[model samples]
Target chain A: MISGPIPPHPRALLQDLWLEPEATGLAEARPSLKVSSSAKKKDADPTTRGPKAKASQGDLREDDPRERPPYQGNLDSEVFHLESGWKLLASDLCFGKGLDVDFLGMDANRTPIAVLALGEEDQDLCPLKLLDLKAWFQRNKELIRQTWMRICPELISLDLCRDLRFFLIAHEFSPSLIERLSCLSSFDLLLFRLRSLGVRGQQYWYAEGVAPWAHHSQEVSPFEAPSGVEAELLRERINTFLSRVQVVGEGLVGRSLDFEGDRFDRRALIENELVLELGVDQGQVWIRIPGIPDEFLLGTDEEQSRVLDCFLRSLMARNHPTWGSVPLGNSPRKPEQTQNEGKALGGRPEPQPREDRLSSSEPEKDSPWGRGNPCRSSKHAERSEGTRLSDEEMAAFFGS
Target chain B: MAKFFDRIFKPFQRHVALPSSLVPPVVGIASGKGGTGKSMVTVNLGVLLGSPRARVRILDADLGLGNAHLPLGLKPDRNLQYFFEEKGSLADLLQHSRYGVDVLPGGSGLSRLAHLNPSDFRRFALGLDSVLEGAAAVLVDSAAGISPQTLSFLLASDLVLIVTTPEITSLTDAYALIKCLALRRPGRGVSLLVNQCDDSQQGWRAFEKIRDISGRFLGIHVSFLGAVPGDPAVRSALAARTPIVIRTPSAPAARGLRACARRLEDILEEIPQWRKVPSYGRRLLEAQR
Candidate 1:
């Protein structure tokens, strides 16, 4: 079995290894191999649609916001399993080092099912990931059995599993990928087009059995990436999201605004008591909590997200007097006050209370921004003249 | 299984996929030697490029040994390890810094990603494109040096901004990296950034030195993309985990970073529509091969 590398011919680099005139001609010589009998049948059935036909639709783009499926959930819940006839043992099962499956459970036949879901962005690599996962599962059958038993401890003495089924869900499976699936005869491969249907303006994701005729598809709702425009969406989404989010806090350090940069630390009177400094410059929105010293950007991702939590609470409390009427701690809104229509946030809608609309907007006679703050100097009074925050914005700020 | 891995790990097609107009320009920040302030410059540029019209992302490509997250005062939950190990996706790992720019924090001090093979590059790069789903621009803060891994990244990008300090070794190494890229990809756009300069003249002189040599010997014109002067304010800002440009806009280095960012933006705009190109991962695999 001794072997050595062989030298290439001198003109190898100049040769076009990919394309050949002879190969193109050979296809014509063997027409049957190039064009299947199904192709000729297509002439008889003009209504038969292929991937190209489905893809040509103007609004069918995978990335188009209009084309997004209704439901945006993991589809591993009891509601989905009852609807789809599958049992989910776990979501996001991890291997010791590298490999992890998106889902693992059992089909109706008690046959173990492993699912790998990908989105339109990862459509190209869907087949490859499937192959990798299949290979891993085949090699580590005992590992799977061990984990399966661990999950279902009661199913101990009996033979835990026999046939393993792999399910792949994506927005759309390319024709080539389905064609490749034909060769993978040994594995019980189930391909589905991830789908969603709106139920009263709400999106609930489900799996649709993919057939040649079922060309339409979508991935399990991929969280849309946040862009500059999405930042505005975040503001709108946060308004509904933060309506109920509040903090039980006390003192806010009153600091003078540095009148240098493009943004000014303008005082916002939410009601008449609590004052919030908002950062809004040329349409960019951010919130600043002066009481919490977040001078440098020294904050973790968790702490920053807390800013979104305190957004409505801090913004709404801007005008409420801190000494008397201020809602500090859990004293502001009782759980009973929020018995109204749900306010939508991040797709999941929370009912908003009509009686308790976050806060009462009654104007105070001694409003700081509306009337002259007799307590402050004239310079401080003039600083609050212009309110830049159209609505309001904040960072992972208003740090608690 | 072998057949499947082969297809997955296969190199690029003989001809590139046609370059499309929608392709966002990915810029790589590289320095041949350490202590060239590449990460600092990358973070600042990311901050400067943040605007209403465009979204910017800084990819700390330093792998296991990265500190790009430190400057922004971010503690990311997941790093490159999480992505490579399939524990998390790129979006799950993104740390939205308080500065408005998103930071794709790199793995810190883990040898797992230090020796990535071609297949890994392919997987990582393909995933990198999804980050562009929201962002208009991505700045790859390449680790200091011309390692095969680093070079693969430099070649995958549309533009390479080589950051160098006034130190002789830094300049020499920067030239070395540029030369390597020039050889691998002839006439590849290489921009020069002279960091830690005493003044604009010193920065310009440093740029001139590298640009002249590369032009004379390599016969390639290297762009001098302005310079950031040495300032004590940079140190103060670093301590605060805030970029100097945001902290002290009047500082010399802040002004320089702003100018460089604007110049880079112009260069990005001037880029002629390329024929459709492969995804970043596919390009990475091609470069690795």
Candidate 2:
């Protein structure tokens, strides 16, 4: 089988039905559609009486025979090269085996293309005919190459026929024909409506549809490096930040700091348990503690104050003795005094009474920070105190 | 009486369980995203698994854009499309490559084969049964992502080998594929092979992260097959149109692949006899429904 839907014409349907069975047997028995090389001279002559008789016997009969267009005989092949960029290599390039392409030409990309022109008078032109052309091309690419080489040896140096494209130039394409052509994506087939315009007795042929070979180049250009003073400043800032951060995991690169880069969210192991993910969005630095739902923004004063105080308090409470050796550029104070004073200086809401704080902690049974009445323990109270520190104290603690 | 009944009815069963030797385990290699080296792993593993005493066949199931034969340095004249169209048998399409592997090439740009009807699926399954006869193992290189066709292949196989790189995107996609597979075939186990790793440690770390997340969220166990290190020789071999295992057998990636192949062989050997039926095509057809 034929894989796609058939056109509505009964004759075309019948031909399509018989195409598969006859594809091999008919290869030898079918008559050649190509104009014979011996008949080239006669076909080329505009003054010859043969095409006039043939045109009259078919559809091109005018009211008077003398009113026939001047460029009537053998003009189908020449019309492609008149104004179109296509340069014809051979006309009626015969395979000599009942198969021939109308015009063999090279596109701008130096890719070989087979052009088949369907005349209005040709009764045999159908979807099955196009299929036949494609099948013949597939089977005899080397033969077509040899014939082209025999005709013009120098043009063979351009490129071999790795992907030969087919073009059907017709007066009008039926909807069914377009549908049939759409199914043959592998062939890279193109259909063009051949528009014949007579301007001041000059016949001009325009191939109107987009050529398959004329697609834009799909090559991707390398990304250009960022330049200018702002870019340099941003790069320097990001580099400085990354150089200061400690990256401690296997195969873990330094936390990427550049906001504009694709890997802006940098993850680094903190305290050997928590993952510190730092990212920048809209010129504001944001930090997220992975496995925790809370996000800390470091761009604004209030958020910076809250996050820094919380971090320092958590560290100090968790490792109180090691807190003295942190080199935070400040003297270590008692955990109780640091918690009380940090909250007082930070302009945060006043802490509830010790009993109320203890009561609130009861409902936080599953909190990662701790379970049940954190204020009941002096260590938990100190850590909670660290979460409410002043902006100035945090700035001073970091020596920024 | 039991022997007489067995003799009378065994030949008439629709689901005939062939001998384990005749019904080689089908391993489907897949990825969540494209360019994760699924085909590369499948081809190299086929070569590693093949020996004088055993035979391995690779079926290129990436219908539209298959390049599995590229590494083998064989350009097949016919492919699965010919077999699908009845122009040739599955045996006719099997091309022997340089490294003692049989490849059933998936012809490029044949989109029709990506989706098969019921009859076509039966024909394809029967064709595979004939092609895979007497093989020790059959590796199916599936197209990346969770397309219906890829899912069908994964569902049909006895095992799925998910290939991924250390990149976050690759890991995320691999997880997505595991999630999809878990939702569809919850009982099936998938093996993870991290490709292009900086080291075995890095590969293990990536695998652990994916495994932990999958276990916690999807409640599925992902087996760690192993990792193939990123080696320059692999790229050079690819450019030269050869498998790195054959071009530079001692290279880090090749050695890693050999170790992975051994692990896979051990796993295949442990499979029970009842699961060794060559019914991947039938399973795939049922999955498609």
Candidate 3:
């Protein structure tokens, strides 16, 4: 990762790679494989079109299950679920998933570390929650700091947080949740916090009566402003989001400060509400609030992304425990019993047929997927959509 | 299961699917004056070279007046004016000729397109990319006289094929076009095709006069691409609303056009890496943006 400015030609160079014979050949080859696979599977199963065969495929049966199938293992019963940090954020806070998130999983550095699958299936109504999240972070402050130091040795030159990631507040949440998480040493360098929230329900239908943003709106209804409790909650969420962003630290400040060259009067600096003039001083990023006469040296875009990543990890470790705060330390519940009681009951769990899966599984590959008619094949479309959405989230975070 | 079955079986519907080849090379037929048979050459040339796989898209770029389709005895469903009508993409305006060629009928509205500002130009280019992506070539039949819009079309193209008859007036006008283009782009390619030439000697004389003068004075290389014989079959084909190539395959004009197209193809193959350079006027706008 050299730090000089990226040449404009690099965009064209990347385009060339996508168009190269090897790349195009691979793209063409994929559909052929899928076409053959379906043909083969059809040939192998004489009753492939029968109801029994469809049942055996388990698409419907799996959809009906009210539990976090066996693999999830009473994560609801856990004392600390890493996903609580996410729940603490406003429900409407807009977060998009890119391709990488589904692949290289997010890490929470506690002893029995956990990974949350904010995968496509669970993304719409994320059920994971944090338990004793606040106390745990306060107790393990040193470990959290050490973890970030080890993971990101050169966090000074990164800028992933600014360009690739942002949170649009959905609704306000408990102050304790926002305050405890925001208090972390990291989570700085966040720019462009859009305050408005547009909410819609399932009744909203477009072509063919299908809800495009089904995950966010439960059903696809036309976009409308949030109201009543949702509106109030959204306002608080915006406040907290803005408050958490204003907490300036060494790494976050480093991202905004232009220290490449020149020097100026530090005290003469004035923060015009919308714009902040930042410059570097003695290899440090200084912060000046709107009313204050000081300048902050926030590092570049790359540095800011790395610091935010650290904050997310620490927050995940303290907050998320099990299915809705059932700390992982608790005794496991019977699978059948939990199946009858879990909240993943109502609302569609599976993605719609023919929707692109690459948007979920491997988001880094998002650009190429949208270019042509490659998604015409239902098989490729379904598989790509199911897997790609998670990868998109991760890619968004890293690339975000 | 029924839904899955339909999805899996859908692609098999096409009985004779052919791999799509690149679009036909767009050869814009332009000249320095009217009645030079620019439209006649473009129509007949397109008909002469068009194949089932390599489809020709003859764009009538003439502003206010266009006769490429009429001379060829065809009427398009929607002319080039529809391309700028804000309602449709270029894809919707494409009309296929009976002879297996696609024609973008030019209209007076084209002048407005020529005056598009920077943002409009970028949007226009993206639409053009979709239109040009599949065509082997786009033959822009530019209006007679080098107007600003006509110059834009000429400079934007990969090859500027200038058509002129054997008369002294035609030769001088053709030479003037070469001189104008030479002053602007001293190193660019300019092909000369003698349309309505009574004989090979006259055609060669016209080509030589233009080529020699441009080379000596302007230091420009004006190539003699090929010459079309002034044959009665071309007039009869126009009267019948059919291309000479389709009406009489052995016609001297048809034969000459095919040869010219082949030579143009060979020249294109020589510079396989020569990318489609955007119009210089458009580039200037982009720089400002």
Best by lDDT: 2
Candidate 3 TM-score to native: 0.37
Encode model 1's per-residue lDDT on A245-307: one tens digit a residue. Answer: 222223231222121111111223322222333433223444544233342121345655676
Off by over 4 Å in 3: A1-400, B1-25, B108-125, B271-289
**What value does the lDDT take at residue B30 in candidate 3?**
89
lDDT digits (tens) for residues A217-310 of candidate 3: 1111111222223334443543333243434321232222211111211111101111122222223444333222333334555654554444
Best by DockQ: 1
Instruction: Give the docking tier of candidate 2.
Output: incorrect
Q: Which of 2 and 3 is ahead in TM-score?
A: 2
TM-score of each: 0.40, 0.40, 0.37
Comparison by TM-score, 1 against 3, better one:
1
TM-scores of chain A across candidates:
0.30, 0.34, 0.15
How far does residue A282 in candidate 1 sit from its true spot (Å)? Answer: 31
Least accurate 10 contiguous residues by lDDT in model 3 chain B: B1-10
lDDT of 2 by residue, A22-71 (tens): 32233332222222342243233223222322422332222243453343
lDDT for residue A64 in candidate 2, whole number 0-100: 41
- Each candidate's B-chain TM-score, in sequence, is 0.88, 0.88, 0.80
lDDT of 3 by residue, B49-110 (tens): 44323455677767457777876577767654565567788777666775546776666444
Give the TM-score ranking, best first: 2, 1, 3
